[model samples]
Target: MKKYALNLIFVFMTTAAILLNAYSCFAKDIAFQSSVDKNRVSLGDDIILSLTFTGTQSIPAPDFTNVEGFHAKYIGPSTMVSIINGSMSASITHKYVLIPLKAGKFQVGPVTFKYGSDTYASNILTVEVVEGPVSDNRPIRTAGVPPLKFEDKIFVVMEPQRTQAYLNETIPLKIKLYVNKLPVRDIQLPQFAHDGFSTEALDRPRQYEEIRQGILYDVLEFDTVIFGTRPGISNLGPAELDCVLLEKQRRTGGIFGDDDPFDDFFGKYTAYPLHLKSNQVSMTILPLPEEGKPQNFSGAVGSFDFNLEADPKYVKAGDPVTVKMIVRGDGNLNTVTTPNIGSQDNFKVYDPQFKQEGNTKTFEQVVIPKIETVTEIPAVSFNFFDPAKKQYVTITKGPIPIKVEKSTEREGLKIVEADAISRPLVKKETLGRDIIYIKELPGNLRKKDAYLYKNKLFLLLQSILLLCFIIIVTLNKRRERLKTDIRYARRIRAPKEARNGLKESKKYLSQGKIQNFYDTIFGTLQKYLGDKFHLPSAGITANIIDEVLKNKNIDERVLDELRSIFNECDVARYAPTEVSVEKMQNTFLKLERIIDYLERQKL
Candidate 1:
């Protein structure tokens, strides 16, 4: 009886060991692995958390009750069956869409499932929720991918080459738009407010493709050059772009098929106004070194080559000679001044006429040699701060040799005049003489006029003559005042100038020169106001007109009409759009009425 009991115990132990080995082998074949589409996701962005089970198709749906910090939704199951070496294998992948409620790191799994009396637990997945959407090209599962959000598909970036720069140094700035599967239209060019810098836009935008975090995106790039005028921290942007998003219109079918005819008649396009702006970027601009600054530097900060040339090497005294000075290279050529040609005592140098084309600046200066002894033109020197070399460079050019001959005509005329004045007077012999006889008669003519002088008609004629003389003198004094007093001259000529400009504009209007017509009309009004108010014509803006006319007892209606005319002209000039003929004519007439009213005003 004892042997039989021991044998029974060993058989029971062997059965238990066999069962445990079978369960271990089954567990090894079946894997419950959890993975996420994206390890990092933005708040409000949906994440795909998939629990994949291989080696068996009998798995139950995963329990996501323990998942926290996210709204979880079951996205149905995807199954794949494969036959390898005549052995059938299957996988069941259960997907859940998880939208993070807040920005934090959260775990998605350890999802438990029971199959064949065995509990299988998937690996826990750690997901990081970021503040902004992830810019990546990761493939999104069909069931979990959400609709494209504006912040996700399209964005603007204002990127500067460097955030730190020296004062007056050129900073290359790039304003770029990244697009991913979004259609846009009616795009207005980007703009930014650069108050403290000298800014210049480059050529038109360029299109290209770039990859950001595994996502391919179309990029539109705009380039610009900026120079910080002052030293300190300067804010660059908040670059703004205006565009219209072209969204696909949904087709609506009536309760009865093919019944809605109105839907077909209407265009199948919908546009949403989208204004995109980039974040502001700050730059630290350091002031240029003052220790080695040249005294003659005129705020030039670029690489440049200086050249000086004279047109005619030989010329007569008192004749005009042109000195051409050219500055060529890549730099801020707009602010470059003419090189100091040294004291031009021997040559009368006028102001240099500056002309710029591309990277070259030419200064055409007219100089007249006064003295015949001057053998050479003065040496020209240009001083600039070379930012690349970090030093002050003085470029000295030649004392160009030239032959200056005395003007023979002037010298000869002077000698002749002097000789004529100093020569003694020659007495010519008097060959023929004429004799005249004088007679004394006529006493009867004087007595006849004595009675007429006392008549009333004669006194009346004399009074009329004196009145005419007084009128002539008053008119002469007024003309003199108009010439001497600038304010009075402008006020007097304003009306005539406006009238002339309007008449000229009519010809342009007749020839379909819309731009010229608007320009003429705008200039006429601006000049009329400028002269009447004694303000600078160049400084006359819409705001200035309003401010100046506000105090003048002008009618508000007239002011409004005037401002409207100015605004229209401004739009036409700057925007250059098609304008109607009737609109142009009406604007002309309104301007005339405004001028007439302004002329009648007391002030």
Candidate 2:
């Protein structure tokens, strides 16, 4: 009886051991789901693929190396533990965001985790990367419109307030990205072109929480100012974008998907690319007006007010007069001519020095003060045509009060008493005046030889000095005439100057002297403008040349070439990029062509 009982016990024990081993190998407490809303994604577009792992106990963290196709960024790692009807369950999940760098199709295999010698993996996923629109093949219907696929249904666009503008004109470029009923997250954006423009990204994209084109979509929008290089037609391209979208898998009752007594509330989420495009825009760069354009027009296009003051109106003969010229107004103050103090005969007026304070962005100058001093200063007038009112405006300052004394003054200004002043005035009326006229006593003055030898030497020295002055004056007049004539001036000096500039630039490039190259090009062009058009270095711009050429009736093609040269120099001045020898050579050729073309054109 004992032997038989041992055999049955052995059989039962063995059977139990076999059943336990089988259950360990095949049975699983962990569950999972894998899904993505989009099958295709564009470069820079975001996609969300969630992995949910549920088990009787905590699941082990996943090793993501198996899915090597993705450039993954960790979104968040979370765990949930719940108890119901005396049953306990727990899950640990990790969410990741992935972006593709290029276009192609990729496969992401089953994500697996191991815990206590047990291993588990989710279903395999496949994603397609395309060049164009990024969206899942989901139907979207709104406001009696036919069902539309997500890619076909939504669009983002940019609308510029004005397509064409003068160089530096602040143009409002607005962008809006919209779709129907999609959860969205702003993604990384592409770097736009910096073609002679400064850009500022607004604080946040304006979000409109509404539906458009019958589909509920997040409308994301922003604005930027596109400044042109100069007054010429230029294109501000389409603002491209990337976006993240979440699709709720058609939930019936629960917070996420279909509600069921045992069904945990969860939604399958994915990311889609938002491609925003704007229509090709053309802006008419209204060339700056050259007719009646003031020679001193400091490129200022707006109206402004000017004021003048002197530190001390009354001063001794040799005392310095601090004449302050303050021009303040809402206009192009920087471009306005520094007011000239007409003639400096009595007062030795040094160059009218200046101090300017203005906001170039607003085209306003708060204060541009110029100071000069003299014992006596005549009143000077500044003339400006008020464009708004269509009238000539003039500002004049000072017969300016002055203190008069001997060449050397021992005392300051004295106030004469009323009683003393009245007595002198009464005596002047009672006194009779006698006429004392000295005629040019012709040759008799020479007849009375006083200090004959010294006087003769003085007269001869005076004659020689006078003769020299006449010769110097004649030469100065001729030089001024040559400088004043644009055609003659350029014909005389442009070739030599341009050649020197090109040669120096080449030298600088060979020696790796970038700054010197920039200076040479800029100075050469400035000197060219000064010589050819009589414009100052500080006043060179494409618009200025355009107007001048138009007035002179130069060929339009020649003007275009001039603009190209200016643009090239401007790029080298501001851009932090290296220029190649080929590029420099090309630029040199372009500049030479422009100089030659303009030189030949009759003006």
| Top TM-score prediction, candidate number | 1
Candidate 1: minimum summed lDDT over ten consecutive residues — where?
Answer: 258-267
TM-score of each: 0.43, 0.32
lDDT of 1 by residue, 118-139 (tens): 8888777788888976655444
Count residue pairs with overlapping backbones in model 1: 1
Q: What is the TM-score of candidate 2?
A: 0.32
Off by over 4 Å in 1: 1-149, 252-267, 411-603
RMSD of each: 40.0, 39.9
lDDT of 2 by residue, 352-427 (tens): 5666665322111122122223434566566555445444456677645545443453667988898886775434
Cα lDDT for residue 398, model 1? 86
lDDT of 1 at 193: 73
What clash pairs does model 2 have?
164-283, 179-217, 180-215, 180-216, 181-216, 181-217, 298-335
Ten residues in a row with the worst lDDT in model 2? 360-369
lDDT of 2 at 246: 47
